[model samples]
Target: MSTAVVPGIEEIARVQGRTVRVLAAGQVLGGVSFGATVSLGALLAADLSGEESLSGFATAAVTLGAALCAIPLARLAGVRGRRFALTLGNAFALAGIAIVILSAALRLFPLLLAGVILIGAGNAGNLQSRFAATDLATPRRRGRDLGTVVWATTVGGVLGPLMITPGEALGAVVGMPPLTGAYLFSIVAQVAALVLYLVALRPDPLALAQRIALSAGPSGPVVESDRPVAARYAMLAVAASHVVMASVMAMTPIHLSHIAHAAHGGHAVETTEITLLVGTTIALHVLGMYGASPLFGWLADRIGRVTTILAGLGILTLALGTLTLWPDEQPAVVVGLFLLGLGWSAGTVAGSALLTESTPIARRPRRQGLSDTTMTASAAVGSVLAGIVLGGPGYGALALIALAIVAVTALLSPLGRR
Candidate 1:
């Protein structure tokens, strides 16, 4: 079913304005819900298992669930439209939160895993929010629109940590633990998102897209209709960048700990201090990721997408090289992380905009879905691989791995040119 129908360009323009606002709201709420649960997975797992090794399992379960469902979920969005898929994903997330609450009450690990998995599937939906924004935008404004939605996410992500505090207080009142209460907050956020999307997103973007497709009357090789090798390369480069970012970020805590220990002459930094530093680093990185999106989008618009993409790779290369030079310095580590975030933002906006530009409307959803699924999977791989490499080859080695990926992304620039 269509969310809203437009008769022509004027109508489309009016609809587009409303659609962007609604989509941005959805992105923000989605980010909050995602952040609420994800930020504390380790603590929940530790409370359940009492062992650090098993705590990793919680994250693993979630990522595995998302990875498994990513491609299928994207295809589902393509066929069913983003509205239905997004709503269903929210439902899964709600159920997951409920399950976690129940599991925490009963002290059940398996149930926790189940809950986390569902949350991961919800994340699959969350990742596509940017792509959904692109659907209603014109070529000239595609990246900006996409970046705006992505930027909206920053609001919710920032609020998520605070959500847990209130959740904990409520849980204390209700006889549930603070952690269990956090899941309830997640449920509430997801439900609110569902309502906002259902009401505000209007008829549906995909349906509007179909109507636009029918109305356009054979425009110059509809962007979605054609798929060049360059498009595929763009997708690969985006995914690879995600992989490298995830892997390196995953091991940052360990790397930082090593630095602390060496600096202390074999005595590691206090756990609390390390945690605080890591938290700050991650927050800064996320800011860098979303904060610069608009600028990157603007850059992609002015320069060719390939040029922006290559610039991102060049930044990434420099960031990795810096890390390699001073793996133990906190300032350098922070700088590297910030640059990594900036590079990802640049590559993501440029590459995704290019992908949208290349494909026709009919194929856009599925292809975009494919791109997201691949990127998500790559992120999962990078997270796991970073742990392995950090344990064995060391943090410096992880920097080299990032450098290698940057090289590959740089090589793909030619594809975008063609």
Candidate 2:
């Protein structure tokens, strides 16, 4: 018979508040690095490979790396706790950034891919931190807590792309390749995140939750019934949404550059204009992704996860439809991308909250890890195919394809009355 050692509700709430604050701070800094990398990774790949066709490889590598690392990190969290796993993930990102700098200096495409893969591992940690927020949360507040952490990323995500021109200038001052300078900023940002995680994430939320549950006796906390089915549905929804978002997002910069050049009568587009367009578009998209998460979370808790997911699909369809109608138009592209981010935000937050609610406490981390792995792996495949489609039938066709996928996801959703 296990003795009950449950902490008081007020104590639990206090710890939860502290945990979220620390996680949010780390996420902000981590977001800076990730946002900058997202803006530059594909461009750097195209430049290094000397083939626009391979542009997707960089994003794909990052997603694939995230996929590869997700399970291991989750297992580590399961065994050692969230702090250990998060710290290790940041370390991998730091090392990867270093290698990326070296690869850029030497103009080695393979090495660059290797380094990006490590950065992806770090992303796995960053992504998992949102879930960590839910470990000690009351069932009623799970979505809201998750949303707060996701929303925190907005600060860094918005600032990241705006740093590109300055990052290049910094590179020039340091006698480094322009494209490589972002990694320098990334290195510093990741180090700060790693240190924050190591020093501040106290009481180890997962371990604490586990102890509290065990203290409740052999019956444990009341877990949801039909968890397996709900878990499967949640995973599918999250993965499908991620595929749509990553496929289009991964190809956006390349598309923007091509159209800009064509509009200029086959001459290279001015760097300043390209930076302005891409940076502004990406900044807005990130805003859409993170800014509305709180509302979506509240909706998830109030309306239901399935309804939130269906709403996300509707928004995604609208986004894809807009892109299909106005393929190369900058304003339309910006609107579509922003909608895309918004839709993804809805699907991801709702689906993740549902997954957490549905799974058994002891098994939550593993299932969450599996969900992330599937999401990123599908995203990797979508990204690679996106490159092929964009290079062949063009952006209009790509939008049509994404729209079709959204339709299929809707049809397959488990939301209908059973």
Candidate 3:
């Protein structure tokens, strides 16, 4: 079970290096798989459900799935190690991918929702992989190592949305419904991730770290700091940031589609053309979400974690301002989405790093799992509410609602300081 006993710090560093690289590779594939979900999930769901308001349910379902799985996956990592938990998660995604294809072919909205929820469960692995990078890391380099893994998602994140054309072409060969073709590309990518986890993740990071902590005796290496920022603040920051981002991001595609519909005089717009616009915009957003993670991580380590988190909130507020001001402009939407991604990256990195350093080694996994669950569930609620808001007050209203959250989070963040 996840063994590769390290004799010393040097050996541990070597192993940590290997673990980061492997996890980075896995992240690349995970990012690719997620591209389809974010860019096309709402589109496909709306088309199948024939109810525009239900579009948010796509994002909600996936996030809820991840929320439900977060703690269980963490406990699994605690018991069986990350290798087993990550691989099992990937397996669920693979099956979900198959189900999505079948559901799309049959035009079954409920089945599609089920498939996507399972895919979200698989996403728990992607979320946790960054934390795994910190397992053997010394306190000094924890941010950098975690950010490196986060940055690796940039490549796949940018490319996954761009896969629409080729993915559709590949799917036409097999007669898949339009948006569902992107999931075809996802299948291959996720399979690669599954194999990578099974084959390369030797000396499981969490398990090995647990062993090392246990060797330090009962108290577990005293990871707690004398006046560390309240872990609750870090968790709250993460959850709040995620909610704003997910709410706005989840509604974007549908908003754009409405524009397309209006532009075409209420005539049906070609799905491909709509997806093209969505793919490009979402690609930029994904790029922002992951591209500067290293810088954010560095800032967290150098400039104080709370400061970095506040900066992220500021960016998020500005992003909402842009979207609320120009709700109908595609270029403006692109800029806003990109900013949203950047803000998410900053908050997620600084907040997660702070939470990690603040927590005890023995409690780290459970606490981190709780944070993920809170973050993911908050996002799920936002997305569901986003659909209702978008359906009622429209996109600008949605952005303004998100803006209010950024303001609230920024005001409360400093109080988390011990």
Q: Write down the TM-score of every candidate.
A: 0.86, 0.96, 0.96
Give per-residue CA lDDT, model 2, range 1-418, as digits (tens).
Answer: 2335766777888999999999999989988888887888888899888998899998898999999999999989988999999999999899888888888889999998999999899999999988999888877788888888999998888778777778877888989875776667787889999999999999888887777766744423324334777778888889988999989988998999987998899997777677667777888888888889889988988898889989999999999999999999988999999999999999999999889888877898899999999999999889999999999999889989989878987887774212
Error of 2 at 191 (Å): 0.8
Per-residue accuracy of model 3 over 225-267 as CA lDDT, tens digit each: 5334568889989999999999999999999888888889999
Candidate 2 lDDT trough over 10 residues, lowest sum: 216-225
CA lDDT, every prediction? Answer: 0.73, 0.87, 0.87
Evaluate model 3: give its lDDT.
Answer: 0.87
Q: Which pairs clash inside model 1?
A: 2-203, 3-203, 3-204, 4-203, 223-359, 223-360, 224-359, 224-360, 225-360
Give the runs in model 1 whose Cα sits over 4 Å from its true position.
1-6, 36-38, 42-60, 100-111, 161-185, 216-225, 254-275
Sort the predicted structures by TM-score, highest score first.
2, 3, 1
Highest TM-score scorer: 2
Residue 138, model 1: lDDT of: 77
Instruction: Look at candidate 1 and tell me the lDDT of residue 340.
Output: 84
**Global Cα RMSD, each model:** 3.5, 1.9, 2.2
